[model samples]
Target: MVYQLIKLLPIKHLPTLLGIAAVLTSALVAPSAQAQTKTHEGWYQVEMIVVARKDDTGQEHWPSNIKLRYPGDWVELKDPNATEVPNTTNNSASATATAPVVDLTKEAFYLLPASERQLNTQAQKLQRNPRFEVLFHNAWRQVITNKKESKAILINGGQTFGQHQALEGSIRLSVATYLELQTNLWLAQFDVNVGQEITQTWPEIPLRPNYTAATINNLSLDSEVEAELEQALANENPQWSNGNFDANAAAPEANNYVTRQIILLQQERDMRTSEVHYIDHPALNVIIQVTPYPSVATTPLPTAQ
Candidate 1:
């Protein structure tokens, strides 16, 4: 009956009827298409490695390794209370499932095609015009001890020390977009000490972009307190070097360092999948890769036998 009604319609009216029919068809098909295009959101495995060089002529070295999982909920919520747990999965088995690890020792890592054009472009710009060098220089001077006078000797024709040490580390972040995954940002920390042998120094390096000199200055007090605690522990327990001292006495210093590091890490910006970013430093190189976690298949429960 509907076909007969349409067949009896005038030729001019048929075009209008067809247009309405087309609209109805599109309205019916739109939802299914939208449903088929799933929004890709999930936890991503983030791996970062800290590579360093002692000096300009020294070979590269890897001093630190970090692995963590970034949950989709945390990224979406952007809440400070959200906790990021560690990811224990070994990512080597499935190539398609996760981002490949960047080995800094190998030359191929730097040669890999950049996942995002903007990231590549920004990195080049930063390399060409580094505004943070002055900040780095000041931070290095504050942390590194200068022993130029201690080693000088006028009686022996003014002998001096020529040894120096350099430290560098960077953080790379990748994120996924609507069309593809790419690197978003890079944060780097670097330090160098030029003098005779001195005590090991823990440089107050910022892992986040907003980390400021004032915050580092405040954190310096913690180091002094830590040193006092260690000295007290050593003096009170002569056998501390032989492992006879109370471990409880060292808790405060350890806790202080860990807490501060956690705060710095928490301040870092979030990243997504396939984004490749690097923070460049004279002494340190950090590369971070972000990739989606592989989906696990759920097994169906068997019916009662």
Candidate 2:
């Protein structure tokens, strides 16, 4: 068959034909120049599922000595049900701010409905199995930026006891050459035993690790002074990064969780669009997908007659 096919085409022209085919294939598979430049700049819709294993008979051993605590800076996920608070100033004594406004990135970070989740089928399959019990699942949208600019979104679910939830921590999504996911979450069974102290304690840290404290508070300092202050703070506290709100618990809050045992799930992963990624533990498991979503639609031109 190979000999017959080669005979149909002139041997002298085979090199040119192959070269043309290669160029056409590259055009179809490779991304355009514009797309290559903006891979990490645009908005992305993220969906995830968290499930616990009912049976870990054959699972690998996990370390129990490792300590787990919440990160200092984590932003609360924007609630879809809640209205946006406008940053309005009173123009007159009698007038009040009417409308709320924010940048496109912040506006796009709203949580999506469960119906919009792409992993509904996957969740269902896990639910049907006897070895797995679905714990929590949700979907949201945001503008994913580089590692230096990305914010850690606070995540909490499962049974609520007093002021703490069974599952709590933060998920930070960043793009440093590639999409990176960092999860610093912990699962605990809590009780209402008041005054009971736990070993875990959260250190008071800045809300925005990427920004300076003065910037977060809107305090303007001399460039040299700010730089010196940041360096001093960094030297004092290793966790300090020239690093949001009451709901975010970004500043400081009461910790009322009473748990004898806490299981920590800390892992970092590199992911690609349109593919499902899974992070597994002996007691907990996570399934997630991050897809690029455009705020505006693109329509192709009509074909020529």
Each prediction's TM-score versus the true structure: 0.24, 0.55
Error of 1 at 285 (Å): 2.8
C-alpha-based local distance difference test score of model 1: 0.28
Off by over 4 Å in 2: 1-39, 57-64, 84-106, 191-258, 296-305
Q: How many steric clashes between backbone atoms does each model show? A: 10, 2
- In the range 70-171, model 2's lDDT, one tens digit per residue, is 455455655565555543576666765455343333455566777888878767776776766677788877777787767777777765433455677788
Which has the greatest TM-score? 2
Ten residues in sequence with the least summed lDDT for candidate 2: 244-253
Off by over 4 Å in 1: 1-43, 52-232, 236-244, 248-277, 294-305
Overall lDDT per candidate, in order of appearance: 0.28, 0.57
Model 2's alpha-carbon lDDT is: 0.57
lDDT of 1 by residue, 128-201 (tens): 43221111110000000122111110000010111101222222222223212222212222221212243333
